[model samples]
Every structure is written in C-alpha cells, then in structure tokens.
Target: MPYSRRAAVYDVEYTEERDVGFILGLVGQAAPSVLEVPCGAGRLSLRIAPYAGRLTVVDLEPEMVARTVAALEREGHGGRIRGRVADMRELRLEERFDLALIPREALQLLPPEEGRQALAAAAAHVAPGGRLAVDLATFLPVPGGAPDPDYYDPARTDGVWATDWIRTLSDGSQLVRQSAQHHDGMSIRFDLQYRVLQGGRVAEDWAAGMRLHRYSRGWIDDARPDGMAVEAVHGDYDGSDFTGDSPRLIALYRRGPAAGR
Candidate 1:
C-alpha cells in the first residue's frame, strides 16, 4: 500500500530530487553491470543508465517497474535495461553486477529481520570483488543523529510531525504530499497523504504508509555476509568523511573471493 498508490503521481510529487552526484561518481564513467533495488520511478535509474553497461532494476511494485522501464525507453536506453517486479528478500537473480546499491534509505523501510534478509539477498548477487553501497538514514528525528527541531515536533505522540511538499503540475493542478512520522520505540512509522487541488478545490485524495526501522550504526557490519567488509563510509552524498556531526551514514561494502556464487 505504501508505494503502490503513490506510483500514480510519484513523479509529480518527487520531481525536484537531484541527489545522485555521489552515486554517479561511485558508478564512475562506466560499469559492467549495475543493480538498482527498488528503482522508485526510475529517478536514479535514469541518472545511472549511461554508465551502466547493463542495468537490472528490481522493485516490489509492478507500477514502479513499468514506470522505470518506460523512462529508460524514453531515454533510448531500453535495450540495456531489465526491470523486474520482485521482492528484494526473495530476489535470486542468476546474474551478478559490478555495483549493487540500495539507495535512499530504502533498506530501513523494512522490518529489522526482513531488512537483514533483503540485504543478504542483495549481497548474494554481488560479483566477487564487486561493490555494495547502502545509504542509511541513521540519524533522523532522533536525538543521537542531530535531530531537526523544525522537522520533529514531540508535542504529538500519535504522530510526531509531518513534512509536506507542494508542487504544481503542467495541467494546472496542485499536488500536495504530506509525510507524517513518529518513532514507535522500535521503528519510525510514516503515514503519507496526497491531495490534488484543482480550481482552488481538492480534487483527489490518496494515502500510503511505511516504516523505517532504526538500525545500529554497526548493524551492517554484522549483517553483511561472510567475505564482505566495509570498504568506505561517507557522511553524505557529497563524499565527505563520516562524523558524528554528519547527517547521513552512507556505507560501501566490498565482496571478496570468499563470498561464493
């Protein structure tokens, strides 16, 4: 229910996102193959298409897969991309990639146990000596990760605070997205709503929800399969050194020979 309904208007709601510079840099000028887990409307996939010799995008939503493949085709990269509607936890592709990334804090969206399994499933497809990059939202509306006062209003326990994004579409309709979240001791749960306005009146309404669990900073170290080790960790997308003051915990893991097929 989270992304299934949102896929209808996801592009209009999140079109301004331009945070792929670091991800592109990591992919470099070219890569033999690239695997994108949950290719949310192809935002990052479109950016990485040129550098990828071959791209395999997997997502749990069929609508998302269709949108991503359609975007790539529009960009003339359809022949080089494969879109699969599959759950990351049960994904067992026959092929491996030079780079496999679970971007935009997506891994955290799963329950802790499923998150680990999903990660392991991804790691299983990582070519020997290949790279696995995961972007983590370690510090959010929490105390340890430098919480933003404006973003988190502890006044509401049922729902701490809501962040809204409003955008105008080409057809003159205004789309408003409100994402409200709260920490439920174990995970941060989110409730999302989308409102479409036309002629100064609400025309349509849609809703979705998902959870992002808080993982220990070192959880990846333990969750990663054998023969994989942390190669690098960056604070943010700018490739800055990770620090306590950093707002994000982006990590890169390398799979070695011991990591079997």
Candidate 2:
C-alpha cells in the first residue's frame, strides 16, 4: 500500500470514525501500558494518551510516523507519545509493556510466518501478568486469496465498508487470474489494476484490491503460541463472548512467567 497520499488525508479518511471511545473504555478497564504497532496517524494513541502510563507508537512508514507525531504535537501530548518507524516483524523496543496491540488487522498485511514471528515478538515485550491484544480480519483470506462476500449485505452492513480487485497473470505454463470484491457506498468507484506477465513477457493486464477479523473461537484457540495463554476472546469491541463463527476475533493473550529468555 503506497501510503504517502493516504498519509496526507488519513485523519480525515479514518481518525474520526475509529471508535476511540470504545477503545478508550477498554483501555481504562485494562489500565495497561501499551505499545501500538502500526499506529497510523496516532488517532488511537492520542485518544488513549491521558489514560495510559506510557505509549510507544510505531508504523512502517516514516511519513505515517511523522503524521502521527504531528497529530500528537498538535494535541499537546507530544511528551507522552513516542513515535518510531519500525517493522512489526523486527520490533526492537527495550521496555516491556503491559499491553501490546496490533489493531486493524495489521497482522494480515504480513505473511503467515511473519505473523508468527510478530506473535513471538509481542510476547517478548509483555511483562509478567501483562496481556497482548490483536485483531484478526475474518473478512478474507489474505496474501493470495479472494474475498467471499456472500455472507454480507451492502445495504444492511451499516457503514462505508467495501472492496474490489482484479489480478491477471498468465505464464506459458502457469496462469493466475482472479477478481474479487465487496463494494458499498463510495467504494464502488475505487479500483486497483495490475500488470500481467507470462514467461517474463507481457501476457495481459489485471486490476485489483477489514473489519476486525471474523475468526472463529477455534481459530483463536489455534492461535495460541507456545508461551502465551488465552485469557478471553471477544466477538466485537462490545466484549461479546467469542463463538465458533463469530465475525470478529478480539483476542487477549497473557504472557506466562515462563515466557521469554
């Protein structure tokens, strides 16, 4: 995702609609020090700034970090916000946090192995009795899978959530073609395109493409790494108990004292 353009308009595009009130309420109850990975625009950080004892906001893009820093400065909370540009898989924070968050399915952007690595990294940062929270987007299979929207109704979904994409690549022996999406409101107008290549030659062209992941309870059960223990899983931000078919996977994992070297 080329985010330079998005970085400029990110706040207007999403900050207001981020549901910080709900997140803050959760943070208040948890009262956990936080390290928010991929903390885009620092919207959540700023919202939870006063409540958290310490916060370290990180993003892969420098511009995003700059934008978040600017927002923090504008809000007079620059002293409380520590902004950095770091890869989720290669996290390098020295201090342990009571809570480490990877919200908005930021984990989905990584390959499965990287996701596991991040889980380990996050676990390494959790102090004894600390918790780790992350969201999974049950919306679609990631990396190389198409979205299936038969379960969703655009008119009733309530929000400007939608997606569409196309990809075409034909090699002499291998052919790859896919078009998938779920569009709503103004999303219908946005489309992504890709170039098709075959045997290193131009074969054709293609065009292409979460709510909290709608992972099942079993999925969460399976996500437990070796050193973490599952505390509770929520279906949504409201703290509903996770069901097997829940549309969102809100998970909290605690790092056992045995974890970490």
Candidate 3:
C-alpha cells in the first residue's frame, strides 16, 4: 500500500491511543532530548511536548509529516519540535538525541533486514549513555491473527464490523479477506474496497497485503547492539518487567561510553 494512503486512516484506525502519562513517566526518568521515529501526525510528540527538551520527529509518509508540521505550528511549538520526511532505516541527523523511541510497533513494520538497518541508524542517533525504547503490541503470532473481513462504520459504537472468519495462506505469511459476516462456526469469504482521501476527495486506492509477526523474546536479544548495553526489557510502556509470556517487549538500549570512543 502507498504510505500516504495508509497515512489517511492512520490517526483513526491504526494508532494506539495510549495515555501520554503512561509513556512519559517511564521515559521521563531521563531527560527528554527525544527522537520519535514514525511519529504519525506527531500524536505522542505533541502529547509529551512540555517535558521534551528537544523533539525530532520523522515519518516516511509525506502527508503525515506535513500534517504533523502544521499541527506543531498551530500549537506554537513549531520551533521546539522538528518534523522531517525520512525513513528510519536511513536516518541522518546532525545532533544525537538523549533518548529515542519507536512507538506502536513501528519497528515491526519493516522487514527483518530493514529493521536491522533501523537499529543501526538508531544506535548512531543516540549519544553515549543515551537510551532507545521501542513499544509494540503484544499479540500471539498464531494462525489467522490478521484483521478479519468486516465493514467499518464511521458512526457506530463498535466502530468496525469484523467478519467471522479470515482465510490463511499455507505458508502462514499471508492473509486475505475471503468473505463477510457469517454464522458462528460457519466460514465466509469477502473482498472489500478502501479509498484514501485528500481534502475530502478520493486521492488513491491501496491494494496490498499485511501480516503480523509476534516477535519472540529471542528477537529482542538478537537485536542488541555490539557496543550498546541492554538497560531493561519491559512488558509495556508502564515499565513492568518482562516475563516469558510478556506480549510487548520494550527494549531499552544504551551505548556504552567506551566502545563508541
């Protein structure tokens, strides 16, 4: 799918609307010279603006970056927060941040190789003793974990009407909507269309595939940097310690003073 197309529904559908206090209390222990990667519409960045010493935000989608920039300007924080159109895997910045964050499973959006590149770029962006934090949704990567076929009612209580069953590919790497609402235990298939709008006009139509990968605990350990120290692995942004069944893995990495010298 086009990044802009996805960005249109980003704020409403894809965003994880967790409280700022929840994330701030954990990150605030360290000063907030923070860089937020894939900061869609600058939601979290704006939320933590008061505490932030310096905020550098980046998003791959131009529309998202533009919206965030405009919002910051309207909030009179344009000078305090910098919004850029950049990819996390190839981030380039003049100054290093005291802390960096990849929120709402933004890291998982990338394939494994690109995720590695993102980690390398993040390592370069943080100063020695600086921290890097990643927040993800905890979900078991079981078969048919993708969104089921359903209709989204803009004005409704449930908001979205998900289908009863979703078809799974043999390789477990792909999922496609087969049918619409069906009776309990009765399977159905469906094909749906989505439209992206700009200025209230249809701009594009996105057709792509999506799959979920519940990152194993081993995945976090493998991502550890050569010179960086693993500060903490938490279950969530609330700073609870990680356990074997912890769904979310918030890995805090710190580059040691000696190795980077």
Candidate 4:
C-alpha cells in the first residue's frame, strides 16, 4: 500500500485512536530526540513535536511527506521537524535518535523479509542505550463467518450513519464498499479488497482484508537484530503486559551498549 494515492482520504478514513496518545506519551518518556518511520500525513508527528527536543520523520511516499511538512507548518512545528521521503528498509542517516518509532502497524504492511530489513534499518539509527518501539496486531480469526453491514458503521458524523454496504468478488479478489455522510456536506467512503494466491491462482479472497502480518512477542523477541534487545511488550497503549489474548502488541526495544554511533 503506497498510501500516497489515498493521502487525501487517509486521515479522515482512519481517525486517531487512544493508542496514538499512549504511544506518544511512551516516546516522550523514553527520549527527547525521536525518529518516526512511515509517519503518515503527520498525524502522530504533530502530536510528538511539542514534547520532543527534535523530531525526524520519514515516509516512502513523497505526497505523504509533503502533507506532513504542510501539517507541521500549519501547526507551527515545522521549525522543529525534519520530514523526509525515504524507504525504511534502505534508510541511512548520519545521526542517531534517542528513540525510534514505527507506529500504526506500518511494519505489518511488509512481507516478513522486508519487515526484518526495515526493522534492522530502524534499529541501526537508534543511539546506544536508546529505544525502538513498534506497534503490531496479533492474528485473529476473521470476525466469524459473514460480514455484517451494521458492524462497518463504527463512526458517524451526524444523524446519518453508514449504509449501502456491500461485498463483491471480482477476478479472484473481493471488494468491500461502504459510505457515510457527515453534517457538513462531506462524505466518507472506503473500498478495501485483497486476495490470497496459491500456485499462481487465487485460493481465497476477502473484503476489507488488511493483508497485515500478525506479530507476537515471541516472534519479535526472536527477530531482534544484533545490538538490540526486546525490552518490553504491551498489550495496549496503557502499558499492559502482552498476552496471547491481547488485542494489540506494542513492543519496545533498547539498543545494546555497543549499538549505533
């Protein structure tokens, strides 16, 4: 998901949740210098600026980076933020940060190999004794059977709630469409689709499929790169201990004594 094409609708489609603030607080407590990879639309960056001594954010999409810069300028934090367009797997910076964050399950978007590469790249930029934090979702069974239209209307802006929800299959892929109208004459719509392939053919298809890689504490701890250690894993933004039943996995890692420049 390049996400650049949908940059305009991204912010509205996915509103900030409580977890964002939780992550921001954790980052603020960990360090004053922060590095945020895949900082989409500057949503979290804006919140991080006031508490951070210096903030550096990067995204693979130029449009997203531009939006972040624009947002920073609008919020008067442009002077303190350094926004760049770069791939996390290939990131190379002369400076190190006291804290590095890959929030919003951005790591889950990549395949396992690419995800590892990105993690290593992120860890490389962490200053010794510093920290790296990543947010990921644990694998859960698809809502048990058929999708319910009413379940999709989790957000509403006025008297009108989301409706006309439908799911369809096309060329071995499934597509889901839903829309809602706001009181300000504006409307929000989402079209999500994905397919699972096997032997060059589609084996399964699902609507609203996130195509995310499910992560666990064991997996993260096992995948830690040299010079970095998994420090803690939380089930939520409130610093709860991660468990098999936890809905979210927020993993924090600390750089080893010999790590980074």
Give the per-residue Cα lDDT of candidate 1 at 260.
42
lDDT tens string, model 4, 28-102?
A: 686889999998887788888888888999998899888888888898887778988899999998879999999
Candidate with more favorable, higher TM-score: 2 or 3: 3
Q: Name model 1 segments beyond 4 Å from true.
A: 15-18, 141-163
Clashing pairs in 1: none
Give the Å error, residue 57, model 4: 1.0
How far off is residue 259 in model 4, in Å?
A: 3.4
Model 2 ranges off by over 4 Å: 15-19, 30-32, 140-219
Model 1 lDDT vs. the true structure?
A: 0.78
Give each model a TM-score.
0.88, 0.69, 0.72, 0.73
Q: Write candidate 1's Cα lDDT for 1-261 as tens digits.
A: 455777867677555343488888878834579999988888899999998899999999999999999999999999999999899999989999989989876888787788889888998888888888888765444444334222334445666445566788779899887767777887767787778899989998877777777766667677776668888888766787777656667888888877542
- Relative to the true structure, candidate 2 reaches a TM of 0.69
Q: What is the lDDT of residue 55 in candidate 2?
A: 81
- Candidate 1 vs 3: which has more lDDT: 1
What tens digits encode model 3's per-residue C-alpha lDDT throughout 188-257?
Answer: 2122345444445554454533433345566677877667878888875467798765546778788787
TM-score of 4: 0.73
